[model samples]
Target: MTDIFNKIETSFRASLRGEESTDKLIYVWGIISYVLAFLLNKLIKTVHVYFFGTTISAVLICYFAWHIYALKKCSPKKPKLTKEEKQKLREEKRKEFGKKLMRKLLLQESFTKWDPIFISIVIDAFCIAQFIDYIIR
Candidate 1:
């Protein structure tokens, strides 16, 4: 983790701050979303699931899963917002961002926001490792 943070700090200091320069931020988001997903999966199994009036393995499923919905509603325009329009848009964007944040935090929606294959591999490895730990412990 420290090494990853170090790498990100290096990347940020050397960044170009453009479209491609988003790689570092994307990388961090990838790590966070996947970790949250796996933990939430286990949490649901260990908490929410029960059978015959007893708690069962309820930590491995998602009920109200988070989902990511892209919003391009605020794309740049040659014309800027009027003050009232700006306030209204700010409120709307605030709500939109809050929902997205909750989804991301809850692992309901992934960073589908990035490369699927890489993300899937990371998730697979995470699951394998978790199963291994479960067996060993």
Candidate 2:
């Protein structure tokens, strides 16, 4: 567990250093999606695998978001905004946050992550298959 976290933390720092989080992030979530998918396949007997899937998907979204936020909070930093621009930026962020929250809540199959679209597609396809199988069975 600590090792997993340490790896992600290292990657997170690398991202702050202007490095990409491609393998670091996608591999981490790929492992997560695999384990979670396997568990849901064998253990969970819920009606909607998407329920657990969506929850875990939201966790991944939040993980990336929090990592970005932490990076922004730590690095070279940005120029201080003027009062007007600050308010506008804050409001824009609030709106964007609401939209993302809605997307996760809706379990939108069309959604894609900024960092890893293919990975998100693969994970979602696996989850959706589990869900459809549950319904079919």
Candidate 3:
């Protein structure tokens, strides 16, 4: 029992190490939770709603919580440029590609970074709605 608990603690700490680990942990817990929920719903044949609802909610909560932690912990890198360097780059871009193209490129760069976070937020919202439905029904 002590060995088992120690192993679990080690695994949990490793999962907290980075975004990748948290992401993998989310998938693992989601699958495990769903399987347990299904087993309880099928075998016990009672309290199915409770088991399924709680399991789903717990998984979502775990995912979102870890996601927020990962986001907070991993700070975005600062732009490596002085004011003069930035001005030179802006002038060069304007001369080479025009201001309109520069704006588009910047937008695309930011969008790529933000896209996953936006999608995850939408998913979290959907999960919350489903959890509410599970509770009400």
Candidate 4:
């Protein structure tokens, strides 16, 4: 049991660092946001509460949007290469298939850090719109 817990903790940390797959974290955060919105609708039963929640959710959406924009801005762009250089690179990659595969996997893992933030933004925007409509009515 302790070993399982330790493994889980390690994996969670790795995911936080964008070194492991984050699909599950993304899904869990998305579901939790939706559930919170649903519960707020059912339990709050007040326009003021909904308005407050919507405001907070909108703020979160903005924050996540800014984060994504920053990430995109900070990402390094690929350098331009001539046709012959491209062909040479492709041939080298073909010769080193294992290294190419590893690099591809690493690049995929690195980008996964944004998945949860994107999911959160979408979920928060939806929830904000939902509660705003509820409040308006």
Best by lDDT: 2
Q: State every prediction's TM-score relative to the real structure.
A: 0.25, 0.31, 0.39, 0.40
In terms of lDDT, the poorest run of 10 residues in model 3 is: 108-117
RMSD of each: 15.6, 12.9, 7.1, 10.6
- lDDT tens readout by residue for model 4, 1-137: 99988986775565545554434444543466466657756654554575675665555455445433433333335699999999999999789987756877888534334444555556666666665565456
Q: What stretches of model 2 exceed 4 Å from their correct place?
A: 1-4, 10-19, 46-120, 125-137
What local lDDT score does residue 132 receive in model 1, on the 0 to 100 scale? 43
User: What 10-residue stretch in candidate 1 is worst by lDDT?
Assistant: 63-72
Q: Deviation in angstroms for 69 in model 4? A: 0.6
Who is ahead in TM-score, 1 or 3? Answer: 3
- lDDT tens per residue, model 1, 35-111: 66567556645663334112211222121111111011111224777999989988999889989988989999885
Q: Report the CA-based lDDT of candidate 4 relative to the real structure.
A: 0.57
Candidate 2 to truth, TM = 0.31
The Cα error of candidate 1 at residue 1, in Å, is: 19
**TM-score of the candidate numbered 4?**
0.40
lDDT for model 2, please: 0.58
After superposition, which runs of candidate 4 have C-alpha atoms over 4 Å from their true positions? 1-48, 98-137
Q: Could you tell me which residue pairs clash in candidate 3? A: none
Q: Can you write out model 2's per-residue Cα lDDT over 45-136, one digit (the tens) per residue?
A: 54356567556545544554544443344334369889999999989999898788787789973475553545455555555655555444
